[model samples]
Target: MSRKRSRLSSEEEMSSKLSDGGCGEGQNGSETSITSATSQAPIDALQSLRQAAPYSTEPEAIAERERCHYGRIPRAAALAGTAHRKVRVYSDGIYDMFHQGHARQLQQAKTVFPNVYLIVGVCSDSLTHSRKGRTVMTEDERYEAVRHCRYVDEVVRDAPWEYDEEFLEKHKIDFVAHDDIPYTTEDCEDTYALIKAKDMFVATQRTEGVSTSDIVARIVRDYDIYVRRNLARGYSAKELNVGFLNEKKFRLQNKMDDLKEKGKKVMTNIGEKRVDILTKWEEKSRELIDAFLLLFGPDGRLSNIWNESKGRLMQALSQPPSPRGSPPPGENGDSHSPVHSRSSVSPPPPKSRRYETLYEAQAGNWMHRALNVLATRKRPHSGS
Candidate 1:
């Protein structure tokens, strides 16, 4: 009896084996038993098996599934919902010198839309070369850097040409956003037309002073002290005149008027020396007018004769004063007067030449003398 019982237990174990050839009962009974065994597995193990399988409702998967169901909606239909959904798209170039202005522009763009999707399209180094001649950063570096920006949501390689409308439509874009830069309208219009045709919106935000070119210029200017020093050393009189005086002509004229008013107000308080200096300046100004008239006067012979005499006088005046300190003898009977004391001063003697010619020569001589006197005197007030 004990042997028979042990044999029965062995048979039962064999029947429950994973790969038994057949059931002792029949094929139909074996199928039913196998099904029953699988059903009897632990609930935890079954749960784990289900979990190991891929998720059917993931975001990407759901999008794909929805895409399939919608069968790629028409570009028009995609844009139909744009009016209600405020979506903004921003794009730009190198952004190498990223500053507060750029940040502000992005911030303003974000404020304008409910859903801001910054689609940064960095030009490839090769494409940038074709358009801009060169770029400061490599394509990969630009891509990585733009990716790290807080405002940027996605990055793409911008082609040599403009953004493709079809691609933008496929993405269901709404408003196209950019900084308000010169020529941006012309550039964006070609791309904007497509967006507008699809009934999508467009916007532009004003950026302050930040620009890649401006940044580069600032860098060059800041570090170019050597160049500036060399320029100062080699500076020319004409260049200085143009740069300092001529450039500020309008402002200087206005300042001169203001100074004249101030001088009038303070005239009584000024000293005798200051009065003398101001009188000399006024006399020099009159001499300038006389010189201009001499050059462009109606009498050609008179003007030519005056210029020759003035040149000779200037040469004589430029020479060192004689040690004896005596005036040259006059043609008239009256002897040359003393040069020192203001009370003993005497004007040039009358000439025997034609009265009109002598008068003209004397006037020209007096004007030249007055100019020299003014030049020698210390200026009371600086003129503009």
Candidate 2:
């Protein structure tokens, strides 16, 4: 990419064009015409040089070579482009979980100068681990992702987290391009501040809406599936700090049964003491709908209500149970649990070992029923 080499390439190209013209006209038997035609090559070359945009130290020569390259530009118009130095701009990052935002920043870096040489640097995995803890993709995978982007001209491996005088000098980087956000690390000064002093800072816009961290957060939000995925990838439960689903499913199923029992009791009282059977059914239906709304929040989706209701039930169940020797409950004092309460209020459950998977067939039924509840979504046609 040196100016001397560029000059040679252009000279070779011009000679080829002149040779083609000479051969086409030689059969016409006019040496004078041929000589006159040959003289115009230098004139054309000079015009191509002088009237054109500056490209390098030797702008005219480099422009001529570029003019003949691949899809040829008109000699005159090719010369008339805006002059731009062949810029070697540096942009570096962890580039973890490469996505559209990374691509946008690379595009920003390339757009800073016309005819730019964009070099993207990816941090080594160890360095990335030290700073960012963990990344979904390995360093090499991230490097390949960045390397294949249309805006990137080259990729430097094992790049440092912070740009320094040595790195800039070694790469012959003209400007350090990145977002304006200040990067503070124990290993270096604010990266932007350091580059600003040298006047080589070219701040590009940080892309909005999407980021690597945001993607990681979304993965975290789907807590159970994420832990399972890690387990599938050879990570252990201890590593993930999660437990088996069997016991939790059992406890959750126990809580659901307790709620259903309380709901039926509420319906029974409506029939026996408050009104006729049809009115009791109608009131019971309204109560169930209200409970469903509270469990599912504003969206009213039932998909995860089983787990959500389970968590809420845990708080209610955690209270210690009263001594059984005393009058069973609700006769003269607060009921021992919601299932036995006189008003059928859905209060806490008394402590019991019923959450254990003692019977194999019963445990299987509980798990199957819990899974079904977790999978179900609210139907548009349903009243509740």
Candidate 3:
């Protein structure tokens, strides 16, 4: 009976160890085992679910078949009233310049459902140029731009210009998101018509007053202005693709603008100082006029002195000069002629015709006689 009780107790102890997470270690070790097993339970279940459905008739199997066949998501599971899953949303565009409008569109696609797996497709450069026009950014740049967007969960390069069933199924796209506007192409009136007909088109609200085309239009409208601005900011003309003549023309215009600004500043300064300048000019002009009158006015001190000097000069000229042969004045020797001796200093030069005092009639005769007298005069003999 003791052996039977011992065996029963051992069995109970073994059952207890199994209950403690199938490990015969301590409580902490048992707890760790429990945690690891709990963590792996979901992964194991997922793996089983994935592996069990090839031949079964379960609902999961049917859904898997549908997904494999048509690449369609269970739309009912992600509806408003039901539990939401990760809805794979697809959007495509040239995405040139990658502005806020593009970001807002991606954001709409991201948040349209409770959880969205946003797959953004950037069209290739060749495709974009062929279908629409040349893009400002390259294909690689556009792809990276879309890839780095916060709303995008994945980025597909070289995306199709138009969507087909093969394209949609390849990307596993549940809904195609874009604006509601009818996008016309050369081959079709509406590019999204098929997606719309298939009930896979999701509309996004476009931001008003902003778009890539609108931005490009603004740049084109102010082309010259932007060019000038960049040039002033030290961008070279060659880099800007400006011809030599255009560069010179733009520089000349900039110089003219600078001159205009300087002239305006100068005029403003002049205007501010005009009253002071006029006041100073009035005071200085009075002093200048007074000095001018003192020097050359008709009744000035200079005129009175000039008249006195003229009288003395005329009196001296009226009398004959002392004979050249006569002894000089202040000499002890007596003069030969009975004419009064004159000052020995040379006479003043004759005035111009405009200021002729009294010799206007005798001027030519007097000049001739004076020339004859000067020619006849001989140098005094010097003793050896």
Best-performing candidate as measured by lDDT: 3
- In terms of lDDT, the poorest run of 10 residues in model 1 is 48-57
TM-scores for every candidate against the unseen true structure: 0.35, 0.42, 0.55
Which pairs clash in model 2?
Answer: 52-79
Query: What is the per-residue lDDT of model 1 for residues 15-103, given as tens digits with 9 covering 90 to 100?
Result: 45434644446668767666445433233223333442112233542352344322323335434534323243545565554566666
Give stretches of model 1 more than 4 Å off: 1-90, 180-191, 196-201, 224-384
Sort order, TM-score high to low: 3, 2, 1
With a 3 Å backbone cut-off (N, CA, C), the pairs that clash in candidate 3 are none
lDDT of 3 by residue, 1-384 (tens): 998687557556545665666564555866766655444434433344344212213365345435543445655655552433357788888899999989999989988876665777788988889878888889877876777676775677788878887878666678889999999988999999999998888899998988889999999999888888888889999999999999998888888889999999999999999999999999899899999998899999999999999999988776443334434322222334335334445343344522452344356557767887887776455683
Give the per-residue lDDT of model 2 (tens digit) for 1-384: 698687667666656655666454355547645554545545444543444322222454344334432322222332343323345677999888899999999998987764455777888899989887888899878877877676775677888877667777666676778998888888665857877887777788987879999998888798656654555567766777667774355446556767999999998887687657677689799888888887676656674776699999997658654434433423223336655444543443344532331243465667777777876844354664
lDDT of 2 at 140: 74
Rate residue 311 of model 3 by lDDT.
99
Q: Alpha-carbon error at 76 in model 1, in Å?
A: 16
